[model samples]
Each structure stands twice: as structure tokens, then as C-alpha cells.
Target: MVCVKNLSFRLQKIILNDITLSIEPKGQIIALLGPNGSGKTTLMNVLADLYQKYEGNVHDVGKVQLLPDYAYIPEDLTIRECFNLFGQVYDTFNIEKAIQIFSYLNLNQDQLISSYSKGMKEQLHLAFLLCHDVDTYLLDEPLAAVDPLTRDILIDLIMKFKTNSGVTIISTHLIQDMDKLFDEVIFMSNGKILLHNSVPQLFEKYPGLSLDDIYKEVNRNVPFN
Candidate 1:
């Protein structure tokens, strides 16, 4: 479980206001939806321990694995080498499972990361993260550059992880493709949370509205500073 109580951050006098959220330790996927600069990435970074110079408290209740937006896979290293490096960093590294994920994502282990396509690199990064057995996975825009077919594959991979073990927190603007993927949705503006509810609850309250529609409606009226 991850809990943020009155978390706040400031940059150049622009404040990311108090935010409090609690994530349960169950087989659930949470999506953080907001426009660019809406503090989705900032909040994810804080939760991932990438930024510590913020007010309030961030409580990480279990082992956490973070996949940032520009998640770095050394361009000079081969896919296998990258896996080996991550294996050394994490205590529970499963090389066999990594290979399986690579195969599932149609990634070539022998190729250098620089030689791989953007989508393939994303897949490889996800595979590398999955090798570690962590309780929570924070993914930022996992499908940003992925092709349509690969997007489905990546979504399947994420769902498989959630089904097998661990909870996932995905921060992305691709709401249409995420309707069936998320158990809960969190809407944000600037640095403040505007809405947070279960998928079913949201739909029940606003009938005939898609996630994208809700996003547009929320951001249209509420201008983020």
C-alpha cells in the first residue's frame, strides 16, 4: 500500500498543493488522469522516491518498483546486458521470467537497445521491471510511443502482472484505451486531485460518459495554474 498525506511541493513559487491518497494492497490497477503539467508525473516521482524535498509525508508500505516516463535503458547495452544489470540491482530477479516476457513482447534479447524501435524499448523496459518481485509498480505513460498492436500486448502484460501479484499505478492521458484496464481513476489538475473514485462508481454517477469525456469536462471548466 502507498499513502500520501498532505503531500506538497513547490517550484519557482508555484505550489503543488496538499494531496492525500491511499492505495490498497490488492490486485487493482489505478490510473492517474490529467493534462500535461497537472502534477501527475510529479506525484508519481514523489511516490517513487525520486523527489524527497517535499512537505508532508509519503509512506510506502511495501516494496516498490517505479517505471518513469523516460525510463532509461542504456542505449549502448544489449537487451541481455540490461537485464543482467537490473538483476544485480534487485534481490529477486527472474531471468527466465524476463526472457518469457521478452518473447511475449516480441523483443530480441541479442539486439542493442539503441537498435530497437521505440515500442520495443518500452517493452524491454517493462520486462526488466517485471523481473523484480515488488509489491507496487508505478508506471508513467507505458503506452506513450507504443503501436496499436503492441499497446494491446503491453496492456495484457500489465494485467497479467496485476493478476499474478502486486498492484499497479499507471499515470497516462490515454483514457479511452484504459477503460477496462483500470480499477480506479484519479483525476488531477495542476498539483491538486480533482476526483478519485472506482471505475464503476464514476460511470454510475455520470452515465453515458467515457473516461475521455470526463477528462475533457473536468479540464475544460477547471483551468490549472
Candidate 2:
């Protein structure tokens, strides 16, 4: 399990308050939902080990694979070279698997990432992350800028990951499309977790309401000030 105990972060005097969360092991899919500037990205960064100057602790008992919001794929490197570099760094790179994923995603091995479109870049980033084996998957806005068709493909890939591997934590504002895919929802506001419940439990508590509606209602009355 990945545990966040009283974790907090501050940026230029704007304090992101304390937060506590526990993510169960593999086979669980947690979707994080929040409005813009609500510290969703901040929390993801902290969990991904991108932000180390914060307070409190984020403890992961197993390997965690984090997919950041804007992963920088070197503009000069070819697709193949980038995969090779990542493999070397993680020491678990599989050239054949990488090739298979490229074929599945319809990505050209010779194409440079700098020349790919924004959506393509996002897809490549996800593919690269999946190339490694890990216990927890942390994805930040995996569906951003992706078309609906590609979104389905991405969702399929995630489902396969969970079936073959274990847990995945996806942070996104597009909850409506993902309601069926996630097992639970983690709602956040003002740098603090507001709700964490299974999809069915949340619906049962607030009948006849969509996740988006719940989000709007919560944020509308948030005591942020």
C-alpha cells in the first residue's frame, strides 16, 4: 500500500494544507477528481517524487510508476533512442515489448517525438511508462488532449494493465467518461481530500447524481477562504 501521512506542500507562501491518503495494492483503480488550481497536480507531483521539499511523508511499500503531467521527452532523440534511454535508467527495458507497443499504438519507431502531435506525445509518454514493471501506476491527466477514439484505446490499455499487474491511480477532470473504469473516486478541493469512496458507494449516498454534479456541488460550497 502507498500511504500519505499528513503530507503538505507550500509554494511562494501559498500553502497546500495537510493531507492523508492510503492507496491499496494492485487490482484497485483510484480516480482523483478536482477543479483547476485545486492542487491535484501538486499532490501527484509529491507522490511521483518530483517534489521532495515538502512536509510530511509519502510512503510506498512497493514500486511506484508515476506519469507526470508534462513529461519531457527529449526533442532530439528518436522514439527508439528515448525508449532505450528509459530502459537503461530503469534497468528493466524490453526492446521486443517496446516494439510491440509501438505497433499497437501505431507509432513509428523512426519518428522523432519532437515531430509528433500533442496527443501522440501523450500516448508515447504513457507507453514509455508502461514499459516498466511496477506495483502502483500514477497517471496525471492521461486523457488530456486525446481524441475519443484514442481515449478508448488508452482505457483498454489501462484495463489490461490492471488485469495483468495491479493498482493504478489516475488523476483527471474527465470523470464522466471514466466512471465505469474506476473502482473508487478520490475527490479533492483546496489541497485537501474531500471524499474517497467506491463508485457504487458514492452513488448510493448521493442518488441520481453524476460524478460531475457531485464535484460541482462540493466545489461550489468549498470553504477555501
Candidate 3:
């Protein structure tokens, strides 16, 4: 489990404010839903320790009890090299999974990262993440650049990946097609959490509304800053 208290961050001005939440690595997928520049990526970066200037207390319950490694797959990287780099870094890296994902994606190990199209690179990045056996995963708009077919495949793979014991947080603006995969959803607007609830609870509050519909209603009158 991970505990976050009074978390906040800023660039030239405030981006995330007073965010507090607890996450458990119980094979559950969580969605960070928001518009662009709504601080979803910022929060994910902070949690991944990619940004240094943030005020908060993030505590992981098990220190020596569990592996200390985590995986964060950015949008760009050399596919083959990334696999080798992660394999070197993580002792528990699963090469078999890597082969399976690569074969499924039809990615050539010898191809340069710069050679692949945007969609192909995104698929490769996800494949790299699956190759590693980590406790925490922070995927930032992973499906944003993929084609329809690739998006469907990646989403299915993510669901399969979440069947293990790890905390997977997927930040996305495309909610309708993928919302069903989330056990819980965190809606953010202008850097603050608007609502957080289970899928059933959210639908209960707004009857007959799809995730996208509820999201539209949430930020209906609010203006982005």
C-alpha cells in the first residue's frame, strides 16, 4: 500500500493542490481521468519521483518486505535497448513475457526506436513495461497515440497485466472505451480532485450515464485555468 498526504506541486504557478489519497497494490486498475493540463500527468510524475519539488508525504507500507523496483514507461525509447536496460535493472524481469508481447505486437527487436511510427513506439513502450515484473506502474496516456486496433490490443493486454499483484494507474482523457477496466476512478479538474469513487458508486450517483457523460457533467460549468 502507498499513502499520500497533502501532496502538491507547481511550475511557475500551482498545478496540483492538497491532493491526498491512499493506493493499494491489490491487482486493481485505477484511472486518473481529466482533461489536458488538468494535473493528471503532474501527479503521476510526482508519485513516480520524476519531479523533485513537491510537498507531500508518500509512504510505502512495506519496505524490506517487497521489491523496491518500479516501472515507468514514457512515450519514447529504443525498444530493444529499453528491454535490455530494464532487464539489467530489474532482477525479476520476465523475458518470456517480453517475447510474447513483442511477437503479439509484431515488433522487430532489431528496429531502431526512431524508425517506428508513433503508434508503433507506443506499443513498444507498453511491451517493455509488461516485460518487467514491478509492484507499481504509472502509464501516462499510453493509448493516446495508438491506432484503433493497437489501442484495443494494448487495453486488453493491460487488463491481463492487472491480474497480478500490482498497482496500475492509467491516466487518460479517452474514458468511454477504457473506463470499464477501472475498479475506481479519480476525476480531477484544474489540479484538484473533483471526485473519487468505485465504478458502481459513480454510476449510482448519475444514473444512465456513461463515464464520458459523467465526466462532461462534472466539468460542465467549470473553467480551466
Candidate 4:
């Protein structure tokens, strides 16, 4: 479960202002949506405990892990080495799960991380995070640098976590297929939440429009059909 009330953060200026929301304690996938500099990443960072000097209250139960947009391991280490290192650092890290993910993604564990492409690196980072036993995952741009096949695989893996009551908040600019991935959506602008609703509610309110269209409509502040 994750809850934020009257939260505001600043770094010389306001980044997130007077935001309040609560996420259910069960299986849920939340999409954090907005255009450039809209504070999506800032909100994720706050929830991840990366930034502490903020106003208002933030509360969550169980383990919370963050997957940053640029999360990377030591470049010189092989994939297996990275996993081994993670096991040493985190008691929650599971090698069996890690191996399964690597196999599913068709990643070669013996290869040096430096030799992998950007997409490959993204997959590795996801594998590392998904190997953890956590209640909440704050993933920033999990689909940023991957092909459609890899993206689909990642989505499948994420959805499986729902059965275990894991909550995932994904921040992304790429909204293609979001309708299939997000259980709920939060629209933000200029460091403030514009709207928050379940997918069914959103679709019912804006009939005959995809998520992409709905986002555009919301941003333009136009009446829904």
C-alpha cells in the first residue's frame, strides 16, 4: 500500500505541489503520465525515498524498491557477476528468480555488461529489480529502450507480480499500449495532478477513445465525448 497526502517538494522552486493520492493494497499497476518537466520522475524519486526533505506525509508498507530510468550495474562486470554482487548486498535478492528472468529474456549471463546494447542493459536492470521480493516497485520508464517483443515480455513479467499483491508505479512518456498495462492512471501537469482514475472510469467517461487520445484531451482541457 502507498499513500501520499498534501505532499509538496522543492529544490529552489516547487516541483510537486499539494499532491494527495492513495493506492490500493492489492495487485495494481499505476501509470504516472505527463509531458516533459511535469514532475513525473520527481514524484517517483520522492516515493523511492531518494529525496527526504519534503513537506507532508508519505507512508507505505513492506519493502519498496526503485528502478530508475538509467539504472545500471558496473560496466566491467559480467551479468552473472552483477547478480552475485546483488545477492551479497540484498538479502531479498533471489538467484533462482534472476536466472529465470535471464533465461526468459535470452540474456547471456557470462557477457560483460559493457558489451551490451542500451536495450540489453535495460533488460538486465529489470531482471535485477524483478529478482527482488518487494511489495512496491517504482519503475521510471521501464519501456524506454526496448523492442516490442522485449516490452511485451517485461509487461507479462510485471503483471505476474499482481497475484502476489505487488504494486508497481511506472512513469513513462511512451503511452502506446498503456491501455493494456495500466490498471489506473494519473495525469499530471506543471507539478500537479490533473486527474486520477481507474481505467474503466476513464474509458467510460471518454467513450470511443484510446488512452493516447484521452491524454491529449485531458491536456487540452476539452470536454469528453
The clash count for each model shown is: 0, 3, 0, 0
lDDT of 1 by residue, 63-159 (tens): 7778887858789998888778878877767788887777777767788889877887787777777766778888899888888888887888887
Instruction: State residue 145's C-alpha deviation in candidate 4, in Å.
Output: 2.6
lDDT of 3 by residue, 181-212 (tens): 88888899888988877788989999999988
By lDDT, who's the top model here?
Answer: 4
TM-score of each: 0.91, 0.88, 0.84, 0.91
| RMSD (Cα, Å) of model 3 | 4.4
lDDT for 131 (candidate 4):
89
In model 2, how large is the Cα lDDT of residue 82? 85
Considering lDDT, which of the candidate structures 1 and 3 is the better prediction for this target?
1
lDDT per residue (tens digit) for residues 1-225 in model 4: 478999999998899989998887567788899887788999988887888999999997468788887756899999899888999999888888888878877778899999988777777777788888888888898888788877887787777543368678889877876569888999988888899899899999999998988999899963222
Pitting candidate 2 against candidate 4, the one with the higher lDDT is: 4
Return the TM-score for candidate 2, rounded to 2 decimals.
0.88
lDDT of 4: 0.83
If ranked by lDDT, best first, what sequence of candidates would result?
A: 4, 1, 2, 3
lDDT of 2 by residue, 33-119 (tens): 887777888887777777899999889736667888776778788998987788788865567777877788777888878898877
Query: Model 3, which residues run further than 4 Å from truth?
Result: 61-82, 90-92
Candidate 3 local accuracy as lDDT?
A: 0.75
lDDT of each: 0.80, 0.79, 0.75, 0.83
- Which pairs clash in the backbone of model 1? none
